[model samples]
Target: MTTTIEILNPTFARVSGQELRKAPFPRLEEGTKVRIGFLNNQKPNTQELLALVESGLREHYQVESRTFFKGDAAHPAPPEVIEELSRFADVAVLATAD
Candidate 1:
């Protein structure tokens, strides 16, 4: 009598995927009437940073801006917040600081 052992083979299959692409963001134009959104994640110094940016944009560009503060910096801004910003503002500026 003879005993036989089965051999198992392992293989890696490629996942269904496409090539990664660069992020798509709208360009801010000068001398154009636009609305900008400033997002504060509630982190320390983030509000101050955004405030500076807000004033600078106002001074340099012909644009309008609105600020939205996220309750917690640890968590991402919710979809509703993003949707509202998209609807209300032409572009968003997210700021974080240590």
Candidate 2:
């Protein structure tokens, strides 16, 4: 009797090596009004941590910000949410809490 063994990959994969299709958005310009968006991954204490960081940032620079919390951390932020942030924010800070 002969037996054969089969191997399987029981794992997920990540996307990579994509080329940019468009130019990146410009950085915050010098001496210009700045609007920053803070995104929280809804992990424990992330909001508190971001708030502290925001406070520290404000101490050094005059800027505005809006805070957003993702519905779930395991998945990426919704496309609409990202679009809205792009329209409203000049820069974004994504927070991931371990």
User: For this target, which candidate reaches the highest lDDT against the unseen true structure?
Assistant: 2
C-alpha RMSD (angstroms) for model 2: 5.3
Candidate 1 C-alpha error for residue 68, in Å? 1.1
Name the top TM-score candidate. 1
C-alpha local distance difference test of each model: 0.78, 0.78
Give candidate 2's error at residue 49 in angstroms: 0.7
Candidate 1, lDDT over the whole model: 0.78
Each candidate's clash count: 0, 0
TM-score of every model? 0.69, 0.67
lDDT of 1 at 51: 79
- Extract clashing residue pairs from model 2: none
- Residue range 1-98, candidate 1, lDDT tens digits: 89998766467567679888976676766666778898889877787888788788877578788888776887878888888887888778864745
Candidate 2 local lDDT, residue 42: 84
lDDT agreement of model 2 with the native: 0.78
